[model samples]
Target: MNTIAHSTPVAIASARTPSFSPWRCYWLEAKHELLRLLRTPSFVLPTLLFPPLFYVLFGVVLAGGRSGGDMGRYLLATYGVFGIMGAALFGFGVSVAVERERGFLTLKRALPMPPGAYLLAKMAMAMVFAAIISLILAVIAVSLAKVSLQPAQWALLFAINVLGVLPFCALGLCIGAWVSGSAAPAVVNILYLPMAFLSGLWLPLQILPAIFAKIAPVWPAYHLGQVALKVVDRDGGGSLALHLAVLGVVTVAFFVLARARLSRSQ
Candidate 1:
């Protein structure tokens, strides 16, 4: 009775003590997360290689010598947008799903890491990959395709390309939160190819069926393509404000959904 009484207060005190600082815990996890991605070639290789190959096959070889300057510029812009989507969807989304299934997320929760840092690190990495891929495509466009844009144009195009990934990143998070690893790639492909095709990333809007052209504006890919087209060609036909607004809305919506889904899963 005396020993039990003596230990009770200590147990109570320890229970009241904080286990870990959220910030420190998150920082450590974020570093590990980044390292995990770096070590995974399945994630890195497709992001680095696919865009340029798509450009070579579709933009150059298939496009042949027929497209005018505006059409050529549009192809580059759209393909760059396509590349950004690949990183955000496959690289981030599938990885998150796999991590969740593998108990990594559960481990982080057990450690009580700061929620924001883990997500911020993922977003940061996605944006970094998007920027790097965009640069590579830009170089390819300039070198092989002889595509040229003024400095301001280049800056605008790059900005749009980077910003365009955010909403998709959020969407990827939602997918990651919901799907299993085996199903994730299939879901991503179903979403990716359709969005790319319908949104005119595979080809110009003019070349697409009229119905698709009419509905393209509703898709995030279309807005991204619109912003990219505006920058690459220095055209201002589409309302930049509208594109930005739609992307912002989609990002917020997907993030909210992802958060809810994650909480439920926990």
Candidate 2:
């Protein structure tokens, strides 16, 4: 009884341990998150490879002759968007659902770390992956596809791809909060692939039946693809403000919904 009594305080004190510094704490959290995901081959391999492979096949190798450059530039933007969406959705959605199912989220809450650090870390990881995907696509476009663009256009497209992960991250968070670990992957794919195709990421919306073009705006990926396409001057014509507004609303709305679901879970 004496030993048990003595150890209890130490455990409590450890649970309430002081962080070294707030900024350092956040950095460590994010660093570890990146490391953890990097070690997961299932996530790292597909997230990094699929986009570039598809870009190579459909965007470059299949470019046929004269229109190769246009196809390369256009798909570079769209596939970059596709790559980031996977990073955000899988990085957050499947992981969050699994962690929650295993009570890891609750355990984190019980720790002395900062609350936002967990989320911020995931977001940072997704952004890093997004930047990487964009870079790889850019390199492929330059070397293999023979695609060229103004330096400003390159930088702008990179910015759009990196920043574009946000709304998808929010959407993923919502999925993670609502679904079971086993179901999250299936749910994300159901939403991910169809949205990508419907948004004209795989094929131009013009050739799709007219109905798809009419409803394309309903999907956030379409808006993102448009903004990215606009950077290359291939977008199907619309106000840039409108795309930004839809993306902004999506980011805010899904985040709010996820937060509500998470809070209730607690």
Candidate 3:
């Protein structure tokens, strides 16, 4: 009986030892999230289709035999940034809200999952989608739009564009945590359209009103667009360092807010 009692304690101690590694949990969650995203057409289709369609409509059709010097190249770069932004916002924001509403996030939290693992997995998934969208847009731009970019230029723009979405993904997380599922899509659209338009994703900043032009630098989309333009050699008198700094600040701020909100909810 003493031996049995002692063995029970040992077994309990062993069981209490952490059953889940944070990284493993994150990876498993990320994989599942990716699969979930793939299976959901409402999520996957928009991320894949919207950017390319936007590019085709604006970059190719609207530009319409009016080669505005480097304008075509500029449009290509902007649309790529636009696509990345869409991926980050829709993928992380709407989905996170849906998960929270559906009780999926709650279920995961009840498990041995690390607090940050779910968010990390989500951010990784956003980056993956951004990269794939960037590639698809790049291919379409080169082949159909007659956009010509050297390999190095393509690589540089792709890398920076993907990195640029990090802030948006973080911002989306905060939005997801704060907003309700029913309101998320509308909230996202309200944020998305303004950011895209104000930041010159739909059109160049020079064409925008002076007020919007002044505030553009304050937005991550503006910085991301600047980064893309720089890579594509289309940024006219834009400061790379300034844009990068603003994006960095915004990312930090959003992350803090998201962490706080998420912690409080728990």
Q: Candidate 2: how large is its RMSD?
A: 5.9
Q: lDDT (CA) for every model shown?
A: 0.81, 0.94, 0.82
What does candidate 2's lDDT look like per residue over 123-219, in tens digits? 9999999999999999999999888999999999999988999999999999999999999999999999999999999878987999999999999
Clashing pairs in 3: none
* Ordering by TM-score: 2, 3, 1
Instruction: List the candidate 3 regions with Cα displacement exceeding 4 Å.
Output: 1-22
- lDDT (10s digit) by residue, model 1, range 1-266: 45554568889999899776767665676677667777889878888798888887776677664545555577788888998898889866898898899988888667545657778778777777788888988887777776767888888778877877899999999999999989999999999999999998877777667898888877898888888887766333889899888899999999999899989888
Q: How does candidate 2 fare on TM-score?
A: 0.92
**Which tens-of-lDDT digit does each residue in 1-266 have in candidate 3?**
35544468779898889775678888898998889888989878988899889888777777763764366688878888888887788887888888888988789878877878887777788888888888888877777678888899988888887787899998898889888888989999899988888988888888778898888876788888988898777775777788888888899998899778877876
Itemize residue pairs with steric clashes in candidate 2: none
- The lDDT-based order of candidates, best leading, equals 2, 3, 1
Better of 2 and 3 by lDDT: 2
Clashing pairs in 1: none
- Candidate that scores best on TM-score: 2
Worst 10 residues of 1 by lDDT: 63-72
Find the 10 residues in a row with the least total lDDT in model 3: 63-72
